[model samples]
Target: MSGGVDSSVTAALLAEQDFDLSAVFMRNWDTKDELGADGKCEWEKDWHDVQQVCKLLDIPCRMVDLSREYWLRVFEPALRVWERGMTPNPDVDCNREIKFDALVQRLGESAQWIATGHYAHLQWDDATHRAMLCRSVDRHKDQSYFLAAVQEPQLRRFMFPISHMTKPQLRELAHARGLPTASREDSVGICFVGQKRRFEQFISEYIPPSPGKIVDEHGKVIGEHNGLWKFTIGESSRVSGLKTRFYVAKKDAERNEIVAVPGRDHPMLQCRAVNTIDWRWVWPDHDVQQVLALQTKLGGRFTTKIRHAMAEIECTPSQGTSPENVVLSFAHPDAGVAPGQTAALYLNEWCLGCGTITETTCTADLQESASSEPT
Candidate 1:
């Protein structure tokens, strides 16, 4: 249950529904205690708190170590992409790998629906008999943005009990029910392999950062950068150069150079396109007509959340070239689309689905907008 308030309430609510429940905790290896100054992970106190909660509820709360699965399936692929100077979202993969893939295998008929404290909602669209992922009502606490990669069938098999409750409401529910996690602060931050900055350092250890030149749009070398892997498209993180803030315009992996613009107001740097939006099929191996029809059913002016903490932007998605994938165009343009990151799609604050940003065409020209640069 991750020793968090949302999850505690979820488990507690499930019990109230008269379902036999076991509070299974997923020990994700990526949570290596970045909050600590030293390298060692320090979530021991958190686990102890979870143990106390399980004891109080009289449910078997045990840890399922999914470290190897996490590394092999989730971290490795993301690490490789990061090493290549792209910024792919690993949490999307973590859900598919641990939540649906590994958790199903481990729980193995022990539970009917593998539930967690996630703030996203999953229910079968009765007409289509296909699972549809929707945004949680608690807009401030919704996490559908990170759940775009979850398959549709798995979405049907899951339940988010706290989908309708706000964080304050959840806290009140927990405190009233005497759940030990009632006061646990929200666990919202990055949890990749290694620590925060340590992850970058550890990656550089194995993936050597060949020195690259940091240049202006005019191709004048203003300063030196570690390597292309150390930067991402639209990244302004610690780049060396002119006085004002600048964003990465592009990363030339072949030339081992980085292109930067002096400020956010620059047209080229600001003209990032949110394209190649994809919606996954619940049953990819079966006839996809039902899935396509499901997408048609989801047609509406929904909302979109790009960054985790940002509020949802009103948007509408249309049927594109493929049945499984949908083309999403926002009511207005969005910024900070680092290549390889997910353009998470949603409707009514619910996550419809998301796809990796393989290409982001710009508005510079109609033809160029059809084919964007890779992250």
Candidate 2:
């Protein structure tokens, strides 16, 4: 249950329906002595809350330590991506690898279905005869982006109890039920790791900083960075010595440099296409080959999102340089498409699939924008 309002309410609502319910609080992170802002091991506090909720709801609650699985499956792969100077969306992998894959195996022969507090919807598609991922009724809080990599098999055996309610409404429901977590603040930061330590700080434990130069697009040095792993594509906070506000345009990993630009709409930050790997579709009937063919032949259109909480943008799918890779071509240049981020595809409200961005096609017509580049 994660000891959060959403999961607490999920258990409450399920209990209300009189379905046989048992709760499990998965302890995926095992960082000893790593405390959160509240000066306690985040998982320990969360386990206490889970126990309280289970007692209040009169249900069985169990704790499963999946620290090893999480590290091997989610953390290591993500760190490898970071080592490559690319930003990986570990949350997506967590959902796919840990939450669904490992958890399901752990629950073998015990439960027929699993439910979570994720803010996404699932509905049966009659045409496709499959359960499709849909946008939550609370559009602003939809989390289909994070859940995009979850396969159809895993998804079919899942339910999201609070998909129809907004965050405030969820809090109200919990409050009315006298749930202890009603007033608890929402958890933020990395999926498993707490926000008590900065992301760079947490990463530094493993990846020691290799200080490098920060340069503009033309190879002119502007500043210095502690490490390339500490910066993301389009990041501006870590950069300095620029006269006007500058956004991270790109990271030259080969040169061990962070490229900065004065304006937010710098050409390097904008791309006409993004190539992706590790593609997965939630719908069994859909495939990348068909999507590419449709886009290339019939000029089919779909909606896409590079990161969470952003409005979906219309895009066209096409074959990338390799068979395993698919490229998304946007009508206009898109900003902040970092390699290793997900390219979540959608059709209307249904989440189609997601792919890991590997490369991007910079805006070709940057002559005018480059002319005004910061000197």
Candidate 3:
């Protein structure tokens, strides 16, 4: 339990049931370990809330220090990606590596099943004899995308207590039950970074400044950047001397340059396809093969989302440059598509799996023309 209202309500619901109930709060980050850091994560307050909830629920509770595991398994790998000037989702990694994998190992044979407040559903598939991950009833609060990287074995042992309810309904239930966290605001953004610290400032402590050039579409240097990590694809560049606004079109890691274009809707910002690395599928091998076969016979059959809360967009999956990779061809051009972002796949409401984007095919014709022009 993250000491949040959702988890607190989850504990309350389970306590009313006949099963053996226990609450475990995971400490994934240690603020003291962050050398020369300004703001700290309110993990202590969260742990206090968790303790209070467990006391009210009358369940055995314990704190599991998984900070070392998280730093090695999730944060280090993410830092590598960031240093390469690509975006990485640490939350997704935390769900797969720390919560499901490491935490389950810690529990060993003591616990039969693991339950959480994740807004996703799990169903048994008799045909495949495996557990299938599904979307929650609350489409707006659905979090299946973050669990896409989790293996099927992990999904089998997982349960989502709040899968059937919406956010407001869950809060109402918590309030009626007199839960202490009923009115507590939901946590947002990255946990380690907290609510106050700027992302650039937090990341700068780890990644040394590698100043680079910000260039326009025609390869003209427009402004200077402190580091590639400071900018994100498709966001306004905020280049001061420019008469008009500029949006980040691309990040050239090899050149150490950020390419910015004149308007928000610039053609350069739109990507028609993306290639993924380290592709993983939650379905069985046979099931995945069948889907690929169907895709070959038909057109795009799967819908995909590159980030949470984004509407699912139709896409066609095919073999990428390598065996481990999968390339998704979007039905329509999508702006702000960037490398290192996970592309979660779904067949209607069932989340199939996801992959980290390694490359994007932005309006190819326009890119060729732009490159052909004189600098």
Candidate 4:
């Protein structure tokens, strides 16, 4: 359990259904590793809440130290990306490697299935004889994108009890049951990195600052940055130069430089096509020819979600530089397509798959087409 209303409600609902349940709180982070912790671990509060909930529900609760696994599987890879001056979504690796794979292998040997509080749905397909991931009824809170990397075998052994229920419904149920976390505020920011520290401060602990020059689109140096890792693709450049605010457009890792533009919708930040690395399909569509045929039959049409909780945007798919890559072309030139970010594909409400963005094709037409409106 996450010591949150969602997971607590999940356990309560499962208990009501007479299903045997045991709570395991995976301690994936140790505050002692942080330079600014001052010997305080924030997860203690979560642990206390978890134990209280378990006691109230009359169920067994245990803590598993997965800090080593998390560091190896999630942290190392992300650190490499950050060092290269690119943003990486650690949650994707956390869900795929730590939560669904390593955690299950460690603790779910005897259990018939594993359940979590993720807001996603699973449907058994008679035709394919497989479990397909679907969007939750609460579309506003759908988490299928984050679960896209979870393989079919692991998905088959998973369950989401609150798939059809909304967040308000979960809070209401928790209040009725007198759960201690009923009115507790939800956790925010990165999972292991508590919100108490700024995101840049936490990241800088792993990736030491490398001072570099900030340049405009024409290679003109406008300002200087403490580190390229401190800025993301779409964030506003705090460095002073122009009359209007400039948004971070790209990073030159070799030169240790950042590129900023005049507006948020600047064409330099817009791209018509993006290449995804290590693309994973939720179903059994692994054969390249089969995938191509399926795309051709569907006219390569799909609704793509670039980030969490964002509305689906129309796009077309094609083969990328290699078999492991998939190239997605947006219906319209899109801004803020960042390398190392997730690009999740969907068909209506059924989540197809997802992959990490590797590269994008920024064309003159795309750049010129960007809106010139001031923000």
Identify the candidate with maximal TM-score: 3
Mark the 10 consecutive residues where model 3 has the least summed lDDT.
32-41
Clashing pairs in 2: none
RMSD of 2: 4.0
Per-model C-alpha RMSD: 4.7, 4.0, 3.1, 4.1
Count: clashes, candidate 3 = 0
Global lDDT of each model?
Answer: 0.69, 0.84, 0.87, 0.84
lDDT of 3 by residue, 1-375 (tens): 999998998898888998888889999997766564466458888999999988888899999999999999999999999999999999999998999999999999898988999999998877667888989999999999999999787888888999999999999999999898999998888878877788888898899999899999899999999888889998999799788999998899999999999987788888888889888888646244667775666554689999896878898877766656888899998888889999988876778888999888888555797799998
Estimate the lDDT of model 3.
0.87
Q: Residue 205 in candidate 2 has what lDDT?
A: 82
lDDT of 1 by residue, 1-375 (tens): 877788888878887777777887777763443233455453555577778888887788888888788878987898787767777777878887788888888988777887878887776766768876766778777777777777776676688888888889999999999998788777644565322355566566567767878888789887788767677666684655457987887777678788787666555554334555445533444223443454578665456565777756665555556654455556655555566777666544445566666554444334354567565
lDDT of 2: 0.84
**Can you write out model 4's per-residue Cα lDDT over 1-375, one digit (the tens) per residue?**
989888999889887876778889988987866455466587777888899999999989899888899989998989899888877888878999999988888985777888898999999977777998999988888889899888788899989999999888889999999999999987766786786779888888777779999999899999999988888887888877579999999988999999999887777777778889898888755534565566666564577888885767788777877767888888877777788888988766767788889887776555455655455
The TM-scores, one per candidate, come to: 0.83, 0.91, 0.94, 0.93
Residue 71 C-alpha lDDT in model 1: 77
Model 1 misplacement above 4 A? 30-40, 193-202, 235-243, 277-279, 282-299, 302-304, 311-331, 347-350, 364-375
Which candidate, 2 or 3, would have the higher TM-score against the true structure? 3
Query: Which of 1 and 4 is the better model by TM-score?
Result: 4
Model 2 per-residue lDDT tens digits across residues 214-297: 887778887888888888777673555557887787887888888888786877778778889878888655776676554565
